[model samples]
Target: MRLTALLASLALAGCATQAAAPPQPAPKPAPVRAGLDPSFELDAFPSTYRPASSEPVAIVNATILTAAGPRIDAGVLLIRDGKVAAVGRDVAVPAGVHVIDARGRWVTPGIIDPHSHIGVGSSPGEANGDGSNESGPNAAGIWVEHAVWPQDPMFERALAAGVTTTMILPGSANLFNGRTVTLKTVPALSPQAMKVPGAPYGLKIACGENPTGGGPGKPGTRAGGMLGYRTTFAAAAAYADQVREYRRKKDAGQPAQPPRRDLALETVAAALEGRAKVHIHCYRADEMLQMIDLSHEFGFKIAAFHHALEAFKIAPVLAREGIPVVTWAGDWSGYKMEAYDSVMENAAFVQAAGGMAAMHSDNVMLMQHLNHEAARAMTAGNEAGLRVTPEDAIRWLTLNPARILGIDGQTGSLEPGKAADVVLWSADPFSVYSQPDLVFVDGALMHDRARPPERPRSDFELGAQRRPEASR
Candidate 1:
């Protein structure tokens, strides 16, 4: 009752003040009410501005690819406080927030590239490029993330291509190349803040042919490749044993002994302890099997097989053992002896055999068409009678890769409680001419082709790209 009385008193006071104000000259536009909302000032800009506070962003009238099974036509995807709050046809539009009209568009979880080389080296020309080890057999313990430059121009191109997430990795020239960094490719002002926080790292390892064949020495035979992997892992196992003994002694209250510093050996030690994920670059099925055994011997797990062109042959084995294969619909039979038998039905066959398969674009140019890649896989599957649904193909592009990258729970698919990383297509995504109209990351509208706009502008790309490139 006291609260009601106080409210009535305040209302009466307000009315009295308004009535007591002297009317003089009908002051210009009531001073525009500029101070009514301190956060937003009235301006001539038409593009929506994101305030530095928590607010829900809503996308209405779009088809959402949950990447599970059902596609919600004219669906609503709501992001509240930077995460997906609700996603469905029946979701009620919240009041007092921004609404993005997504009519006549397709919405899917952001494209995830399990194997990528976007930011590790921006300029892949002769002088500045150092990501791929064209040198020795194995260059372990070197983290490729440390060398990643946030200012890379490829980041913008990737994002414009509807890539919202990626696993930045080193090249496949070495047997145990280096540590790979998984991050959300959100464009920001700084690289330190651009990195995805607390994401798990992946270790790049090669087996079968590349390590043995591409090195400076004579690794021309498949037998040589097997030997190189085994020998490297064996040395790594010994290094791990040394580190373990030192830790044991220190724990027993004895004098601590520091082991000799070898950056190459530290990676193997980390792999043996299962702290880093092993992403072995291989193409043949037999080599993949050998690599799996090698992983078992090291007391670790093989996370995913990149470019596993022959993984369809071992789909049953991979499914039974729960290993993932990161490959694509188109990148088959282009280069090596191992790739001679590459098939168009690889991803579909893997999915058909109940094995996890993801589509990855290792090429900077190919990544621009990942959605088309997913569509191609679907079309190929339909033609081959392998019969994977469209949603299944979306899964390959989104959720399955997220699982391989250890980021499924955080950012793949249009789920109720995930990051609002989404791609808005200009047309039916299955059609060849479709382009991503807008891309959103963490509930913020990061890209819009229509806007003039608030996109990133890099120093070098000031007059180069259609979009101003910024760091993510």
Candidate 2:
């Protein structure tokens, strides 16, 4: 009887399950929102640079200007695997390392030029030689690296002058010239090969006379220039907002369309986001203040001012805002009205006001003599009653410029664990007669005065050498 009752209960349970309501349809996954195209990414053209092979070596009995600290006399600098292994008065060298007897020589960190146009504005001065200036005044989409002619002979000349790295910027003939590329002054076939790996990109913005009188359709007055900047930055900010909103919606599992990508706006938006550095070419103090106001209005930071002839006038303002000035050393003024008020002690005055200052070679010829530029600035500072030593001035050539270029962590000084980009000078580096006896980039002996290259590094140089005497 109990077994018959259990069978009846099982039948009832089966009937109740069949009577249950149909299950609800499975919820569909949130529609996938497409992200920005990979091609539109800022790093689409990634760096392919690799440091040259380096060897373990040591140099002893030298006067070392570390750039990060006080100079060391009778110092020792050790290089291993492309990085500085040790630097001090008593650094111990490994038994198998090759030691250089650097008696009476001066060693310092390799020079870095914050502003240059070497590869873009190449030598020979032919019709097609210059690719630095674009036809239009707004060229935010352009990248200087794409037009760099690595065969420019100026690179070798700059290397011989102890310039291991340089920021090759676009000519300031536009409101927004373009993106700047930092390159290792190496003899490579392509700009990508000479590009400094992982270096941040810089946007070249111009103020004052250059952009105002750039060309047809450009802003014709200073106020017009400011209006142009305001207009462009406003668009960039709006685009940035769209990007942020798209990202936010995507993160929240909602469907959102990616904004139409604009390469010009992309670079400016990157600057607005602080993902890229802003390097403005401003001359007058009033314009610099206007730029500062513009930066505040748009919520971006100016990395450094190039050719800041009136930087001394607003040194305190620049220092308080943490902006650096990349200017010429000597009196390179009077050609233009805006440049007429420049003083030789600009760098010294800026430094005295607790602002960062550096010497930049804007000309190709000047790039080969950045050390002399710093020397001139040092002399001017001394003449002005400011005690600027070799130790202090070396920073203008090496570390301060490096800071402006945003590569101080990797190089710019002879610190342990930094890139072994160093130079050996025959005498006091500040003296006009002093020359780089040897130059090393990433611990690779790239230039040696004693054993110069038998053939030219640039193909153009080779062609010129082979030309007939009449052609010359």
Candidate 3:
């Protein structure tokens, strides 16, 4: 009885306190905006990634695999003015040049990943943190660079693994996902500093199982997928026509009003204008062919078909059409029906048919072991009776991907007048046991095995608990 009375008293006191509280004011309504201006211009800016090094250096007594040509048994690679000054067995290193005696070491062009999600879909994979757009299937308004977290620790890890450059793409959750940004695997305060200067942006499009997302509204089948591409491209073309007419009339001094700018259609229009390259995620041969037809219908060429497992089945056609296939070696079987036809010799089959094949790592962990990934392809190719040399396999990781990114003329192979993006390996790069002893970007040593290289760590990694082995 006493406990019940005390409880009733407390309840009454709480009610009295609530009744004594003052009334709070309501929140003010936010002011509404008029609308966006149609005359506003979006800047198409060039990259400001200048070389930070001026010191001339020579890596001597190393076996160099110049991806552009034959391997040199004992080569001397000279780096001057942020470029590969020379690469030959008889190239003379001038006096006072910083010499790195790399006897018995192997040297090759820095690895380049044509497809990556390092900064956008970062490690520990949170959905909101990731850059995938699944709202309505079409999402060409997004740019991967805008979502890029420059402090992503994966950038440093990739650099450590000899990946000097990579193309960071938006995820394939949508039919027209977004634009891809090519980046130098160097730590920076912003994505702008990491971007590959003057590299053409790529539009990320997808077909097959990924974009379907199941159920209503989304592409429920392959037919729906093709329809999605056709309809979107058609709309983009119409929008482009409006914009073109507006500009023409304005330039001709005729009274005209500009069309309302659509960011998504603008990106697609950029691809049609050849200002952006098309990088599609496709699997089956039939779907790939349908996409090719759609590209022809839209007048935009597909620069590459990424994750094209069944590209081997249509290798000759792809080669004939001058399209490259970027795929993972030995990463297949039993995932989905689309990936069921995958074979370990897919890369070899494409190469045998005179098609360009590049090994790509869609996974972060696999990206760190790209050389091993190439070795797997090389082994599978050799077993399949294809005469693919180590140099050829290296090109899959370097020059071919560079060409896909449209940055081949700048830095792909250890060629004279190209950026000194090079890697020194502890052994043959095609060997599973090999590791990058040193990595250089634009003639500057970016990663060295001797000491802890100066690289940024994400805030999440800083001051965090690490295992004993991770400290070393």
Among these predictions, the greatest lDDT belongs to 2
Candidates 1 and 2 compared: the better one by lDDT is: 2
Over the full model, what C-alpha lDDT does candidate 1 score relative to the true structure? 0.76
Model 3 lDDT per residue over 309-364, tens place: 99989999998888999998856666988888888888888989988989888877
Candidate 1 segments whose C-alpha is farther than 4 A from its true place: 1-55, 124-127, 188-191, 214-220, 452-456, 463-472
Report, for all candidates in order, the number of backbone clashes: 3, 0, 0
User: Candidate 2 on 41-138: residue-level lDDT in tens?
Assistant: 54767788888897898999999999999999999999999999999998998999989999999999999999999888888673335544656667
Give lDDT: candidate 2, residue 84.
96
Which scores better on TM-score, 2 or 3?
A: 2
Candidate 3 deviation (Cα RMSD): 18.0
Return the TM-score for each candidate structure. Answer: 0.82, 0.91, 0.88
Quote the RMSD, in angstroms, for model 1. Answer: 18.9
Clashes of 3: 0
Off by over 4 Å in 2: 1-42, 126-131, 467-472
lDDT at 245 for candidate 1?
77
